[model samples]
Target chain A: MNYIKAFAPATVANVACGFDIFGFAIQEPGDTVEIRRRDEPGIVIADITGDEGRLPRSAEKNAVTVVMLHLLKHLGRTDFGCEVVLHKNMPLGSGMGSSAASAVAGVVALNELLGSPLSRKDLLPFAMEGERIASGSAHADNVGPSLLGGFVVIRSYTPLDIFSVPVPEDLYCTLVHPDIEINTKDARYILRNEVSLKNTIAQMGNVAGLVTGLMKSDYELISRSMVDVIIEPVRSILIPSFNEVKKAAIDNGALGCSISGSGPSMFALSRGIENATKAGEAMVRTFAEVGIDATMHLSGINDGGARVLESY
Target chain B: MNYIKAFAPATVANVACGFDIFGFAIQEPGDTVEIRRRDEPGIVIADITGDEGRLPRSAEKNAVTVVMLHLLKHLGRTDFGCEVVLHKNMPLGSGMGSSAASAVAGVVALNELLGSPLSRKDLLPFAMEGERIASGSAHADNVGPSLLGGFVVIRSYTPLDIFSVPVPEDLYCTLVHPDIEINTKDARYILRNEVSLKNTIAQMGNVAGLVTGLMKSDYELISRSMVDVIIEPVRSILIPSFNEVKKAAIDNGALGCSISGSGPSMFALSRGIENATKAGEAMVRTFAEVGIDATMHLSGINDGGARVLESY
Candidate 1:
């Protein structure tokens, strides 16, 4: 195939108790990338959409192009070139893994056009390169789930160990993205550099419990275990109406709720789509009551992360 | 059943990645306690053995007596009394959960002598009181597993939530108790009160991975995830020949090795008794080379925590 189109889903990272380690993919509000082979021996961002020309045109400045560059370099296909187009369906800096979705779509499209030279797992480091360029830190919590789909755990980063965690079919996700921006770097900086041993142990216990709860499909345990002791307490202040939104979600039957990724967006989990819908609407209403515009999406766990649309 | 005898197994707390939250029971080298109903309205430590009279006979100072006092108080059986005897088969201050075993046995024997007034789950808080008397902190990492058997995860401490984690039947444990004493308080004091966010995230990742490994019965993942970034780095320095003993255990096919609890005892996990036996021997030899006498025990996960013994 000489050309390919791909779509990658957005993801919610941190997942309450599992900061920097747990995340899961959502089916709606993602990004798309289209790629075509070029005679020139260098990558080019030929066109872009939905970003209002705010993103850079330079290949090095864009997460999608950066991933393509890394992927080609890793494949020893530096002599090959591609013309790329990015369609940003997800809002930027909204903590819905916008950069990760674009990066995953770019590599997935390129991989398909090149006849699938790299496995899905092999492309993680390249996508991580995109994250490094976007956030100044190479974190796989978003990109891993956006690439592999469903629940993903970044087991370790130094040696790059990632694994897929099973999700119960009945579990549904509710995401409320407020009309505000919170940079990932700024959110991370607001956190304490050092956390007490007592808090750390409590955090570990909750993380372990969350994993076990998910594995066992025990919803009560999931609700009880979905607590963040370290990150949310500090970053929640940055997001407007954070407390009210969380309270609304919980009151409307959410199994759990927390700031998704870094902020400006909140995510909740519920056992059924009906409860998820109600929770999502409550979060939106809570934000509206606080004079903040918000949008909500209800989705089941995304089983397919990034995939080719159609080959030509 | 006016008089009852019981034995509780030793436990290895921390389990490398789960400091203050995870522990497992071992079959050998435990503590024995005997209890007899009395008409007098107060608990008493009538006799003691194997501790060289180092322990206090006062109920407020002794872990065994403290557990009995708490148990009776909770049951509103303060009008009832028991005469107790403690036989410490495990060494004192060896980091082999010596105090937790005594506490567990005391509660078990008293429950039996009272015609099983409290369920097994109902007895955790009283055992935690024993831990509080012994370590000055009410931690369930050791006592939970000693009472619940197998691997136990203390999900929370505020409300006292503990759960049993599945153990693979093929898994065997190797423990080496060196002839030295490291006070739990002193060992804990050496650790940093605050840990960096980077290390805490890594710790959370390993803990989640370890739980997943145990649930899925993935041996390789278990080996890879059985790592500690927060506690062992500080505590290992207090244990003599720590590095060499760990190396010997790993070299002999142990899945992982680390200081069992605070210090002076090290534990390793392996797939079979043969590997566990070899690893145990290597740990002993390594300690011997360092001029520290040690005793090794090879055992599987204790499926039964504490049980009533036939009385003479």
Candidate 2:
């Protein structure tokens, strides 16, 4: 097969108390990449769509091409070449891991076009390199789930140990994306360097609780554990009507609600699609009341992360 | 029946990364309480043993009597009376939750003598009240596991949410108690009020990993997650040759090792009794090399927290 296309879903990171370690993939609003063999000895971006010229046009600067370059270098296939077209289905800078999807799709499709030399897990570091280029730091919380699917927990980062946790089958997410942008770098910079040991203990307790609740399929435990005492208090100030939107989601039957990643996007978890849809509508309506136009997506947890779409 | 006797096992709190929130009960080295009906209208401590007279004699000051009084008051049976005999099977301030076992034993025996009016879980608050008197603050990490058995996670303290997590049947603990003391209050006071956010994130990550490791029975994950970046560094300094002892435990195939609660006592977890015993001997030898005598207790995870020993 000389031509291949792949899709990678978006992810929500920092799931409440699990800052910098927890994340999960969603099914819709993802990115796609189509790769074709080329006679040239280097990778090139042939076309880009849906980014409105906001994403970098240079192949070296884009996450998709960066991932492909890393994967090719690692496989010692530097003489190989590919033409790439990235279709951005998710909004940029929405705190919904848009860049991660693009990077995952690129590497997945390129690996397939190269006759499938690398396993899906083997491609994680290349995708993480793409993340390091997009964000200032190489955090696996987003890209891990986008590549591995389901709920991902990064136990440690030095050796890059990542694993997928069991998520309840009925768990659904309501994502409300307000038409605003918050740069990931700036959002990370605004956080305080130090936190009270008391709050730190509280955060750890909640992290354990959330993971246990997910593993045990305890909805009430999840609801109680879905609290962020450390990051949300600081980052929420940047988002408009953050508290009001969260309250609305909770009132509309969300198990819990918080800023999705950095800002301008909020996610609420519920037991079923009905409650998730209701929470999404409530969150959108709350944003509208604050004079902010917002879009909502309701999706179940995506068990299959990046996948090959078509190959010929 | 006019008399009842009960036993509550010792516990190791903090469990490396889960400071102030995680703990599990052990099978031996626990306290016992014997309760006998009396005609008087107030609780009294009639006898004490194994504490070398270090424990308080005053009913208001002792954890066992204090727990009995609280349980009696909660049940509106303040008009009733009981005579208590306390047995201290563990060392004081050894960080093995000595007081929690005593309190749990008292409540369990008293409740049985009162015809078991309250469930085992319902006795947690009174046990916590005993903790509040023994230590400066009421923390459920110790008492929760001692009362409920197995591994316990205190997700929140405000409404007192506590739950037991699934523990691997083969999981064994090696507890080394040095012949020294470090008051829980003093150890807590020595810790810094604030910690770096970076370390806090690491702590939360490990907490998630440890809880997930226990629930899924993943031994390697448990080893990786049994790290205390926030508390162990500071508290270990108070214990002599702490690093050497921990290294000894790890070198002998122990999964992980750290200060059990506040310090002077260290605990190591292993896959089976053989490894646990080897780890325990190594830790004891290391302490002896530093000229500090230490005693070791090796036991499996106690799924039964507190139980009746005799009733007549």
Candidate 3:
């Protein structure tokens, strides 16, 4: 095959008290990339769509091409060339892992076109490099889930030990993305450098509970544990009607609701798809009450992360 | 039964990265309590052994009787009285949840004597009252495990939500108590009130990993995740040869080793009893090198927490 097309799912990070540790992928609102091999010696971003000309077009600055370059360099194929086209189906700066999806899709498509040299796990660092260029930090919570699929815990980042945890069969996510934009870097910076030890302990307890709840498929435990004591209290201010939206979701049968990642976007987990839809409508209605437009995506936890779509 | 005797196992709290959340029960070196109905209108500590006259004789101040009184009050039977005897088989202030064992044993024995008014789970807060009297905080990590058995996560303390997690069949604990004494209160006070957000995220990541590891029985994940970036670096100073002892255990095949609660005592988790024993021996020898004698208790995770021993 001279070319390949791939798709990668968007992700939600900092799932409640998990701050930089927890993330999970959703089936819809993802990114797609198409890659074609070239005889010339440099990668190029041939085209882009859905980003409204805001994303950088320069190959070095673009999330998709940067990831492709990293993978090619690692493979000792920097001498080779590729032409990339990114279809950004998800909104950028929505706290929905848009950049992560594009980066993962680019590398997966290129990897598939080049005879599939690396496994999906091997493509993670390349995707993370894409994140580092898009944001100041190379956080894996978004990239890990988008690349690996399912609910993932970035256990440690130094050596990059990340693994996927089990997702409940009936569990569904109601993702509500309000139109307002909150810069990830700014949201992260506003957080205090030092957190109270008491709050930290409480957060750790919830993290433990969340992980255990997911593994055991205990909805009550998950509901009780999905509390973010440290980050949400600060970051929620950046989002419009955050508390009311969360309350609406919770009141409408969401197991737990919180800011999806940095802000402007929120997610609610529910037991079944029907409950998830109801929760999503409640959240959207609450957002509308404050004269803010929002979009909702109802999806199960995506178990297949980035994968080849088709070959030409 | 006019009188009832019960035994409660000792526990290791803060099991590595868990701080105030994670704990598990050990099968040996526990405490026993015997309660007999009396005509007096108040709880009384009739006799005590193995305490070396160090424990409080006043029923209100004693860990065992204090827990019993709390239960009696909760049962609305404050007018009833009981004669209590506690056998403190484990060393106090050794970070082995000695007080928690006494507290749990007392409540369990009295409950059995009074026709088992509450489930083992219901006795947690009363047991924590004993912890509060012994130390300054009503933390449930110790008491939760001592009362419930097996590995447990005290998800929250406000409403007292504590639940047991699964343990691998072959998992064993090597608990090494050094000669030095470290007061839990003093150890806790020495810690800083605030922790860097970076360190807190790292800690939360490890907590998530450890819980997932235990549930999935992924020993490697457990080993990698059993880290305490926030607590251990500060608390370990109170334990002589702490670093060397930890290295010895790790080198000798322990899955992971850390201060067992606020320590002078340490615990190492391993896949099998053989590895646990070797790890224990290495830790003991390391302590001996520092001119501090140490005692080791190697046992599997206790599935039965507190139970009636005899009735007359």
- Tell me the DockQ of each model, to 2 decimals: 0.85, 0.92, 0.93
* DockQ of candidate 3 against the true complex: 0.93
The 10 consecutive residues of candidate 2 chain B with the worst lDDT sum are B155-164
Measured against the true chain A, the candidates' chain A TM-scores are: 0.98, 0.99, 0.98
| Candidate 1 segments whose C-alpha is farther than 4 A from its true place | none
In model 1, pairs of residues that clash are none
**Superposing all C-alpha atoms, what RMSD in Å does each candidate have to the true structure?**
1.4, 1.0, 1.1
User: lDDT, candidate 3, residue B10?
Assistant: 88
For model 1, the docking class works out as: high
Tens digit per residue, CA lDDT, model 2, B1-312? 889989999999999999889999999989999988989889889999999998999999898898888888888998998889999999888899999999999999999998899999999999999888999888898899999999999998988888889988889999999998999999999999999999998898899889889889999999999999999999999999999999999999999999998878999999999999999999999999979999999999999899999999
Give the residue spans of candidate 2 off by over 4 A: none
Q: How much of the true A–B contact set does each candidate keep?
A: 0.84, 0.94, 0.96
**Model no. 2, DockQ:** 0.92
Worst 10 residues of 1 chain B by lDDT: B303-312
